[model samples]
Target: MFEALYQYQGQLLQGLTTTLIVAFGSFVVGFLIAAVLAPAAVYGNLLTRRIIMGYVGLIRGLPELLVIFLIFYGGTVLLTKLAGRYVEVDALTAGIASLSVVSAAYLTEILRSALLSVAQGQWEAALSLGFRRPRAFLLVVLQQMMVKALPGLTNQWLVILKESALVSVIGLEELMRKSVVAAGATHQPLAFYLAAAGFYVIITGISTLLLKAYETRLTPHMR
Candidate 1:
């Protein structure tokens, strides 16, 4: 296994890079969408809240792979039809969109829970001092919610990272896909897969340390 890994070192690095790119793209986009979604679900009017809730419910009900297929293949069809021109989506674009949607559902819940965890007293205090509710929430509650949400969100981050492997089905040249190619070429399935798993372990291990450090910074009790 080790010899095979050494021989295919360049492929491993390339795969790692693509994996990170896909993960980063999905995570960033998902977090931004979730930031809006959580707040809208809580504070928006009944219709808006219901709409957001329905979206979350729908996503939760579906398998992740199904979601990816729907977005990738479905988007291509819809785009081509709507535009009256053939439109093809690249694997990366489809993968990012699919993963971001899944991540957003979890992130929305994490953020909403964090926001609700803040004391009502603080909200009232700000209102009593003449700050509008929205302004107060933004100025005070948002920061606290982010701090509280970080640990859970980071766990979700790792989930999305691992899930990116599923994009191999779409022909994305990410870590898993690269590993598959190498394994086929070298006839060392176990060795190549073990190497891929090790790469993921390294990424997650480093991420865990960073998350811990950030958590300690945000909440001293974590130390």
Candidate 2:
């Protein structure tokens, strides 16, 4: 067992690197979309909020695999038609785009709740201090929201990380794909599956620990 693992160590590392790259890429893009759209969903006018709400509802209603297929193949077709040429959409791009859209929906809800959780008095106080609406939001409300939603956001990130493995269906060669390939080659499905599980556990463990450390660091300012 040990020798087998050692022999495939480089392959496993490559797969792990691919997994992390896809996860982090999706997270960054998703977080940006969430940061902008989440706040807008909470604070925008009725029409704006309604449109964003529709998007959130649509994304949430669809299956993740369906979304991945739509983005991967559909996007390629659309892009090709638009460009009047063949356009390639790879697994990584599709995974990132699908994950970003799906995660943004959840992030919007998390942030909306976080924004609403802010005491009304905080806003009133900011206004009392002669801060304009924008300034007040930027200076006071946003700060509190970040701290309040950090945990929820971290949880969403973990979900994104796990969901990224689904991109293997499109031939992304991520950890899951690597495990499947190894299992097929070695005829040791249990061993490869267990190894994949261990990898996931390690990734999630490290992510959880890092988030906890961040929360601790922010505790002083939270109060």
Candidate 3:
């Protein structure tokens, strides 16, 4: 069944590279956004908290595919108007931006919960030591929050890994798109499709194992 798949090895690998790039890019960007927004949501004034919560609610309620479409299409139009010429958003850029935005929403909630889990006494103790609020939060509280948030973030990474496939619809040439093309040309849909599924499973499986090990090391008492 995979006989014909052999010829497309290079293409499939290239597609897999794109898939990894999108997933990693989205996760890194999402983590950064969540790092900032999570604290603001937890520590900021009422209006700031409300605004951040509203954004989280809005993005979480929307479909991921819909977000991708809006960014991919809407971004092109907006950029074209701004540049006063034909400006098209790159598919890869759109994939990363949309997924990262969506991922950030969920990550913010995860991190917010983690942040809240931290004891108020920890902050007080840091302040007693003459450390500034930002320093205390960064050096002490944030570290604990990240440790608490690790499992949720790991699962979110897997979610984004799978979600990256949706970018195929926008022509980013990720694994799914490559499989479709290969199956259509080779007339072995099962072979190519199964291969794609297997690829995803392998990547997610490896990721889970690695993250779990890291989690264990981080929280040895829990283990």
Candidate 4:
């Protein structure tokens, strides 16, 4: 095992790098979309809320594989047609886009629920204090909602990290893709897969600890 790992250290490291890039990239973009859409779904006008709802529903109902394929192939086709030329959309770009859209749907639900969990009395108190509606939401409401919703958000992030592995299907050289290539080359499927699993476990374990620390720091002081 040590010899095998030593031999493939470069490939493994490369795989890890790609996986982190895809996961973190998707998370950042997806969280932004969620931040916008979730609030709109909950608090915006009827039309805005309805549109957000429809988007969430459509994304949630579709399979991730199909979403990836559609974004990878369909997006390329659409772009090519619009440009009136052959446009190449790489696997990485397609994977990132698809993952962001899918992740946003889930994050929207998580954040919306978190926002709803904020006590009505808190909003009332902010209003009574002469804070305008927008100001109150920004200052008094969103902070509490973030605290309440962090655990759910963390879970969503973990899901995104795992889902990034599926991007390998489209030939992105992320962890699973690298593992597949190594396994094929060495004819040692179990060894490579087990190593990949260990790497994933290490990443997730570290992430879990960091999130927990952040959650603790964000919690309100108790008497």
Candidate 5:
């Protein structure tokens, strides 16, 4: 077990890098979409709110694995048809896109709640200061919403980290896939599996600590 891991340390590192790339890429993309849609769902007209909420609901209702499969295979088919040639979505692209969809849905709800938690007076105060709605929200409301949403966002990121393992099914040699191959090759499933678990724990632990520190720094008033 240890022997195999030690021998394949370089490959494992590459796998970890791939995992991080997928997780962080999706997280950022999802946050950007959520930052826009969350506000629309909260402040837009009935039709717009309905449309945003409906999307959120639909994405949340489906399983994450199913979403990955759809995006991976369906995207390939769609692209192939459009191009009139064989086109396939690589595992990394599909993984990021699918997870981004999943992340955006949850992030929207988290941000919507955070935005609501902000006092209406904050908006009024910004307006009184001669700030336009967009400027007010960006400068004032967004900061507070982020502070309020930090814990949820941290957890959501961890969720994304774990969900990235599902991408292995599509043949991306991410950490989980690498671990599986190592286990099979070494005939030491338990050792490699536990090692993989430890790797996940270490990454998630470090992320949680960093995010918490940032959260504390952002909300010093709460301290």
Candidate 6:
């Protein structure tokens, strides 16, 4: 087991790198999209609100693996149709796009919940103090909302990180995919998978601690 791990250390490290890249990229893109969509869902017109609601519902309803398959395969087909020839959607692109879509749904819910958690009275108080709607939201409401939102967002980040393993299905060569390959070749499935789990645990532990630190900074009184 140890020999196999030692021999494949380079491959494992490469997989880890790919995993981190996909997870971080997806999280950032998804969170930003959610940031915009959350406000729209919370404050936009009826048509806009309904559209956002439908998107969130659809995403949340599907499994991540299924979502990945659909995006990669469906996108390829759509591109082929548009170009009037067969087109291929690369694994990395499909993985990121699918992961982002799923993450965005959760992020939208988190942000909307945080925004609503900040009472209307706070907005009123800000306005009474001569702050405009935009300023009040940007300054007062956003500060409180972020403090409330951090924990949920961090949880979502962790979720995305783990869900990244699903990207291996489309041959992305992330950690899980590499582990599968190593397991097949070395005939040491348990050892290789255990190593993968260990890596995931380490990353999770570090992220959890970092998020806790950030949360304490955001809400010192709670600490």
Clashing pairs in 1: none
In candidate 4, what are the lDDT values of residues 1-223, reduced to their tens digit?
A: 6677678879988999999999999999999999999888888999999999899999999998899999999998999999999997899899999999999999998899999999999999999999999999999999999998899889988999999999999889998888888888888889999999998999999999999888888884831
lDDT of 4: 0.91
| Candidate 6 Cα deviation (angstroms), residue 156 | 1.1
For model 2, what is the C-alpha lDDT against the true structure? 0.88
Model 5 lDDT per residue over 1-223, tens place: 5678798788778889999999999999999999999999998999999999999999999999999999999999999999999999988999999999999999999999999999999999999999999899999998999999999999999999999999999999999999889888889888878888999999999999999999999989889
Give the candidate number with the greatest TM-score: 5
CA lDDT of each candidate?
0.91, 0.88, 0.95, 0.91, 0.95, 0.95
- TM-score per model over all chains: 0.94, 0.94, 0.96, 0.96, 0.97, 0.97
Q: What is residue 112's positional error in candidate 1, in angstroms?
A: 1.0
State the displacement of the C-alpha of residue 214, model 1, in Å, after optimal TM-score superposition.
Answer: 0.7
Model 6 alpha-carbon miss at residue 163, Å: 0.7
Candidate 1, poorest ten consecutive residues by summed lDDT = 214-223
lDDT of 1: 0.91
Quote the positional error of residue 177 for candidate 5 in Å. 0.4
- Which segments of candidate 1 are over 4 A away from where they belong? 1-3
TM-score of 3: 0.96
- Specify the poorest-scoring 10-residue window by lDDT in model 2: 1-10
Per-residue lDDT tens digits for candidate 6, residues 1-223, read 9999999999999999999999999999999999999989999999999999899999999999999999999999999999999999999999999999999999999998999899999999999999999999999999999999998999999999999999998999999999999999999999999999999999999999999999898888887
Residue 124 miss distance in model 4 (angstroms)? 1.4
Q: Which ranges in model 5 have alpha carbons more than 4 Å from their true place?
A: none
The RMSD of every model to the true structure, in order and in angstroms, is 1.5, 1.6, 1.1, 1.3, 0.9, 1.1
lDDT of 3 by residue, 113-144 (tens): 99999999999999999999999999989888
Residues 1-223, candidate 1: write the lDDT tens digits. Answer: 7788889989889989999998989999999999999999888999998998888888988988999999999999999999999998889999999999998888888998998898888898889989998899889888889898998999998999999999989899999999999999899999999889999999999999999888888888656
Q: What's model 3's lDDT at 169?
A: 89
Candidate 3: regions farther than 4 A off: none
Model 6 clash number: 0
